[model samples]
Target chain A: GAGVSQSPSNKVTEKGKDVELRCDPISGHTALYWYRQSLGQGLEFLIYFQGNSAPDKSGLPSDRFSAERTGGSVSTLTIQRTQQEDSAVYLCASRNYNEQFFGPGTRLTVL
Target chain B: AQSVTQLDSQVPVFEEAPVELRCNYSSSVSVYLFWYVQYPNQGLQLLLKYLSGSTLVESINGFEAEFNKSQTSFHLRKPSVHISDTAEYFCAVSDNEKLTFGTGTRLTIIP
Candidate 1:
């Protein structure tokens, strides 16, 4: 069975640049989530989407972060004005009922 | 609001030795508990989960977790660990949809 997948295994961007990370959840999964893993921040929730309902954006650290799920399958996380503090591995996960499966993640490095 | 905590930042054990990774969570409602493992330069995979039924759940790889509602803990344990078990482990909790993850614990197996 295919698991969650993400694009651009690694990305290096300059500060103030905008970057986008993409995630493709498993087939038939109705729940998708975004998370960030960093040396200082560890692992933190960023956003979550369930079916067509409104996303849970409360975990987003700042206004610069936003995400959208299209057709209830794929998700894109956009960060405006990337900063050094935003350098981290962006992880994607999807769930059917209880246990969630994760993607390889996109490592964003802001210079 | 829900929160997860992996008390140990790192744990080192000799090959074929027993190991335990502590995980505690806080939530106002009953939640699903999960443990994930991330190898170097890789994504996370579901290690085990406790949604209902018995308080104990085990993974195919000989890892188990006991969910204690009163103690608010879902600690992972392995009777004997191999060098291949060296990786980063995460503890997560979910109330309904969104999940909260803890700072991962880096387990180093000394050969």
Candidate 2:
């Protein structure tokens, strides 16, 4: 793809439901990142992947939030037992650690 | 852990008026700085970046940002902003590869 691509632009789930968001980064991008954007809260770094090696996962808010990148290209973010507080725009970005290109984020709303 | 602080939560300016969005950072080591713009319900677009060149860098859209080592600032500015330029701007810094973003500053260009 010419740019990073994310799946399901919008998702609405009930409390305790699980949601999965996917991202397909640009071809040959060595670095990928997942971020969460909430009202009043800035973009929060959730996870990072550099060529399938993720050295950072310190920003995951809880144990329920997890993400993984496979084949160093496609990535998935999973939220277990989703809470209302988990509702936010999940953004996926890919780059070479110099500049990042973002995907149209998935707006996840937990009711 | 490097962090960014966008001084203003919102900035309002008339069309064709000059505007500056303040951003500051805190880090123990040299870092990469970036400015990104997010349009309504859209992905973030890279405006400019300060990697290692001159202290000042300009984006193709006439926006410029100065990387100040003393004040730890990378404030973004445009000589004259257009109504179409209204968007949410974010300041980000990466100590290594984990980018920490600041609370966004919404720029509203009033015609």
Isolated chain A TM-score, each model: 0.96, 0.96
lDDT of 2 by residue, B6-100 (tens): 87999999999999999999998999999999987678998999999799999998999999999999999999999889899999998758779
- Model 1 residue A76 CA deviation in Å: 1.2
What tens digits encode model 1's per-residue C-alpha lDDT throughout A1-111? Answer: 498889989999999999999999999999899989899988888888987554678889999998988898889999999999999999998988777888999999999
Q: Which pairs clash in the backbone of model 1?
A: none
lDDT of 2 by residue, A65-90 (tens): 99888898899999999999999999
Query: What is model 1's DockQ versus the real complex?
Result: 0.84
lDDT of 2: 0.92
Instruction: Please state the CAPRI-style docking class of candidate 2.
Output: high
Report every candidate's CA lDDT: 0.90, 0.92
Worst 10 residues of 1 chain A by lDDT: A50-59
lDDT score of residue A73 within candidate 2: 89
Off by over 4 Å in 1: none
